[model samples]
Target: MPKSVLLLWLEGHLQSWGYDSKFGVRETLPFPTKSGVIGLICCALGEKDPQDDFLKELASSTMEVKAYKNKFNDKTEQGLSLIMRDFQTIGTNYDESDPFKNLMIPKKSDGTKPVGSGAVLTYRYAIQNGKFAVFLEYEKDLAQAVYKALQKPRWDLYLGRKSYIPTEFIAQGIFNSKEEASQKLRQLAEIKKLTEDFSVVEGKNCDDCDVLLLNDVPVSFGRRKSYANRYVSIIKKED
Candidate 1:
């Protein structure tokens, strides 16, 4: 089948690509996850459904990410801090009688109220000053739909979380091949005075890279979200 590649320039002051951690302590991965990217695409298409069929079509698609940082020098590798922690509190002082406020209160799986003040503390981590170029290979027809949706997204497009607004345009363009998208990525990095820091490529374990298994492939997307595992290779740029 014919394929197309999309070049997405993801640059933002704050972004969180969640991989692990729970409600009390949310952590972020160093790079974007397939699930997160798919979420962005769904948002652009204004698709709030489970979208099992749509996601299945690109189940075997190729995705590559190029991480960038502020250029310091050829000998020195310079980048902002990997993680930024933000402390917050949820479900505080809500009346159980008020239906709207009652929904905010923490509840047990059985729908009963929690055993405490119903307030919980959370530690959210995000990437600071993150910049990445993502190359997503898709079927020609699906790629065109995604391209058009991104140009005028139905909903606001964010890097990861809603608050993490992108500094640069996410839709660079669609190309005929991954190589074409990569060349565009290099040009964008050069124009922005950014240097390559690392990369995440979809694949199994290899001798020259760090292999990671992530349960981030989306299977369903509504209230009861489900995911599958995928292997990716992370290769840091050699100094």
Candidate 2:
């Protein structure tokens, strides 16, 4: 049987996928890692750590990805260019002053968990003007259910990092084809009466632009670390 795919477009000023993050400072993995996406699924299901059996089952499924290039336009010349960069993390130097340092370190359950050997995999796609698409493949029934839930989401959508909550619904919907998905997204833009800031288009790569990928590196809290990733990019929307 053919796999069912749910195509979602996340358009926003900033997006981050935090795989392994700790306290005050968070860290973002290069691409949307399996753990990160699984965390999302858990969140959607209103679950937390000490995961249940269902969570394990969900994590055992297959996932794939394809990233695209982001582009920007030169106002003076009305020319478009690709804006891309390799992201890096800068750590803040600080001395460990914790009295419970010995007891706070990871135990077997925390440190032994594998990062990549799971059911979820994500691709990072950067689009021109902050527009990008995500294609999720899963069991047909599950895919359809997820697609339907996303259309009128019960919970607010935020970049993997919770700090950057989207002002609008980032995902448009699941569609039969890319073209159909694009058209539906356009229709949504029209309904919202949005302008170029919310424009959706087709293209894989960007040219002649400086797109920087920011990776959030985790920092320590007091005893336990925060799960949120802190990597973010602030883009000024052109009017």
Candidate 3:
């Protein structure tokens, strides 16, 4: 049997997928991560804990991502998008009386107040206006649920974070094969005048891949999120 491919359009003024981050500098992988993709699916289904069997099915399924440049620029250019860092800071701007202000303070695992404020300046990287085509292999029933949720999500749908909203619709359609679905999606997008700038697929289809270890697989994701380690390949391209 052939696999099912779901076409998604990811485009926004600012979007960030922080695969590995500690404190000061938060960076994004050139493409999306399995954790992020699974998270999106869980959120769509309104699944509180992402480590459930639903997520397990998604994580185990194959994901092939193709990142594209902004459509405004030359389509054939393939100039390669840029990952710009967004400088941000917290705590100082919050009002003392507002309960929301307390969020600026770091809390312990037990939710106890900290000794000092967690206010600090930091940089977050994002692939601005980047488009991506995600091909997935999942059971038919589950795919239908996901497609419905995406059309009218139980929660807000985001690229990698709540702040990054896709400019266009993310759920295009579901088809029997990746090629057929993608081809039809392109046609529809052209009629609607959407972006179709193709990007390199490092691990599955592209070349000169640099495989790296990523620990983004979800072990549990409700109040406490846990993850297991997995190997992923990074694709590099010329500007």
lDDT for every model?
Answer: 0.87, 0.43, 0.70
Off by over 4 Å in 1: 73-77, 93-95, 107-118
Superposing every Cα of model 1 onto the true structure, what RMSD results? 2.4
Q: Clashes per prediction? A: 0, 14, 0
Model 1 — TM-score against the truth? 0.91
Show the colliding residue pairs in model 1: none
Best candidate according to lDDT: 1
Give per-residue CA lDDT, model 1, range 1-239, as digits (tens): 69899998888999999998797999999888899998998899999878899877755577888898887565444554478999999988888799999898988889888887877789999999999888888889999999999889999999789999999999999999877887888888888888888888888746878999999999998999999998899988876
Query: How much is the lDDT of residue 34 in candidate 1?
Result: 90
Candidate 1 lDDT score at position 222: 95
Worst 10 residues of 1 by lDDT: 72-81
Q: Please report the candidate that would top TM-score against the real structure.
A: 1
State in Å the error of residue 128, model 2.
Answer: 13
